[model samples]
Target: MTMSTKRPFTKDIILLDNVEEVTNKIIQKLQQDVLHNLKRLGAVVGTSGGIDSSVCLALTAKAFGPEKVLGIIMPEKDSNQDSEMLAKELAATFKVRTIKEDITSALAGFRCYERRDDAVRRVFPEYDPMTYKMKIGIKQTGLSNNLPPVFSLTIIDNKGNQEDKILPVKEYLAIVAASNFKQRSRMSMLYFHAEALHYAVVGTPNKHEQEQGFFVKYGDGGADVMPIGNLYKTQVYQLAKYLGVPKGIIERTPTTDTYSAEQTQEEFFFQLPYGLMDIYWYGFENGYSAEEVAGVMEESTDQVKALFSNFERKKRTTDYLRMSPVRDYYGS
Candidate 1:
C-alpha cells in the first residue's frame, strides 16, 4: 500500500509573497492583545530557550514591563548548556523574573520504583521535548598530508542521545511515548505557572506545525494565548529584529529542544529544508492550487511535475487538513 500523508488539521493557509506589511500589522495587534490580557490578568510568560518562545517573551515583555513578565526555563537532565545559557541570558538581559526547574527530578519522583536501566515511562509520549543534532566534527579520517574542511553539517538524531530522538507518530512506540511525556510536562509546567502568577501560557508553534497537527491535542496545543502563532518562519525573523532579541537566539536553528538540544523541529519532522516548506505553506495559504504553486517555486520542469503528482496524490489528506472540519457534532 502507498504511504498515507498526515492530514492537515488547522486553517487553510494562503500563500502571499512579501506579506511583511500585512503580517507585521497582525503581529502588532497580537502584541497588543498579549499585553492587554497579561497586565490586566496578572499574567506572566513561561519562556523556554527556543526561538519561538524567546521571541514571544521579548514581545510580551515589551508590551508589559519586565517586572510584570515572569520567564521560566524547564530543562531536563538531558538538556544542554546552550539551552540553559540562552534561558539565563534572556532573563538577565530582559530583567524578567525567572524560575528554573529541572524536570529530571520530577521524572524520578514519578518513577520512584523503576530500576536504573528499566527507566521511567510517561503518559504523553507523542511530544518529544528535547532537541538533538549531530555536530560535524573532525571528518578527516586519513588526511595527514593535506588539509580538508574542518566542519560540515549533517542530520543526527537527538544530538548524541538515543533516548531523545524525535519520532514520527506512526513510527516507533518509544519515541512517540517519550514525546507525549515531555510534551505534557511542558504544557502542564507552563499552565501551572500561568495559574499561580495569573500569567498566560504562551504558545510558540509555527504555521507548518499548526497545519500538520504537529502539536499534541489539547496538551501542547492548549494555550491561553499565542503571540507568535500568526507569524511564519521568515516573518518571525523579521519581527525578531524589531523586538531586539539576541542575535544568537535569532540565529539558532528552530527546534523543540524536546529530544536533544541539537535536533531541529523542521529537520526532524519534514526532513526537508524549512525554506522549501515555508514556500509550500505560502503557496497553499495564498489561494494557489497545488498545481499552480508548483509552477512558482518548483526548481525545474521535472520538479514541478513531480510536485504536481505529489499534490494530486496527497489531495485527500491535504484537503482534509486544509479545510476546517466539515462535521462538528458539538459546538462547545
Candidate 2:
C-alpha cells in the first residue's frame, strides 16, 4: 500500500476537518500510551500560562482524573508575572494538584544569567545585569537577502528600551549555553515531581515548534509523551476551545515566556506569525511550490522562498536535538 501525500489544503495550507474528534483521539491515546506502554500513573506538565501547556494539562486531566494530573509552575527571575498568575489560574480552574518550584535559585547557581549578562555587557557596555532582561535570538534583517540568521542579543532595560546586536560566536555560544540552563532546570523540576508521583512528563510543543526546531532539545522537548505534537497551532486552538481551557490563556498571544522581557514566539524562533507560518510549513512539506505558497500567503515569491529555505535550514540544524542517544554499534 502506498501512502498519500495529498492533504486537505486551504490556500496550500493543511486543514483539520474535526477538532473534537482529534481531541478525543489524543486524550484516549495519551491515556493508553501512559497506562499500557509506560505504566505511568499520570502526567506532570509544566504549566506556563500559555495555550499549549494549558490545553495539554486539560487533555491530561481528562485522560487521567484531575487528582492524577500534576501542574507545576517553575517561575524564574526573568519570567513574566502574568504568565505565573495565569498558570496558577489555569491549575485552579482545572482542579489539578499544583505546586510551585521557583527555578531562579537553581538558575543563579548555574551562573546562567551571570554568563548571559557577561555576553550582553560585551555588546552594550552600560548594560546593567540587574535591571535588564536579555535574550538571544537569530538576526532577522538579512534573512531575505539569503544570509543565514546570526545569533544575537536582545536586551530590554528597566525603562523598556530595547537593543538588538549581533554577538561574537563565542559570546553567542556562552549566552545560549547559559540560557539553556533555564529549560533544563525546569525539566529537572518537572522530573522531580513526575518521578516522585510516578507520572510521565508531558510536553506542550505544537507541530510548529516541534517540526521547526523551536524547542530546547532535551529541555522543553524532553517529555515522555507529547500530546499535542501532531497538532498545528490552529488545531491546538480548536482543541483548546473544546477542552474548556481558561479563556484568558486561550486568547493570550503565544510567547517564549522563557525571557524576562515579553518576547513573542515569532520574534524568538519562527520569523513569521504562527498562523501564517503553520500554513506555509504545511504547504512546503507537502511539496507545494514556493510560488503557489507565496500567492496564498500574499507574500513575494522571494520572501516565500526565503521562508522555506530558513525552515529547512533550521529543521536540518536542529535535527540533532530530536535524535536518540548515539551508539557505535547499529541496532537490529
Which prediction has the highest TM-score against the true structure?
2
- Among all windows of 10 consecutive residues in model 2, the one with the lowest summed lDDT is 7-16
Candidate 1 lDDT over 8-109, as tens digits, reads: 322323333454565455556655665574444434555667677777777666656677777878777656678778877877777788888777766556
As a whole number from 0 to 100, the lDDT of residue 134 in candidate 1 is 28
For each candidate, the alpha-carbon lDDT, in order, equals 0.56, 0.84
Per-prediction TM-score: 0.67, 0.93
Error of 1 at 102 (Å): 1.2
Candidate 2 lDDT over 169-268, as tens digits, reads 8888877788899989899999999999999999988888888787888899889999999888888888888888888998898988776667788787
The worst-scoring run of ten residues by lDDT in candidate 1 lies at 112-121
Instruction: Name the TM-score of candidate 2.
Output: 0.93
Stretches of model 1 off by over 4 angstroms after superposition: 1-40, 110-171, 289-292, 301-332
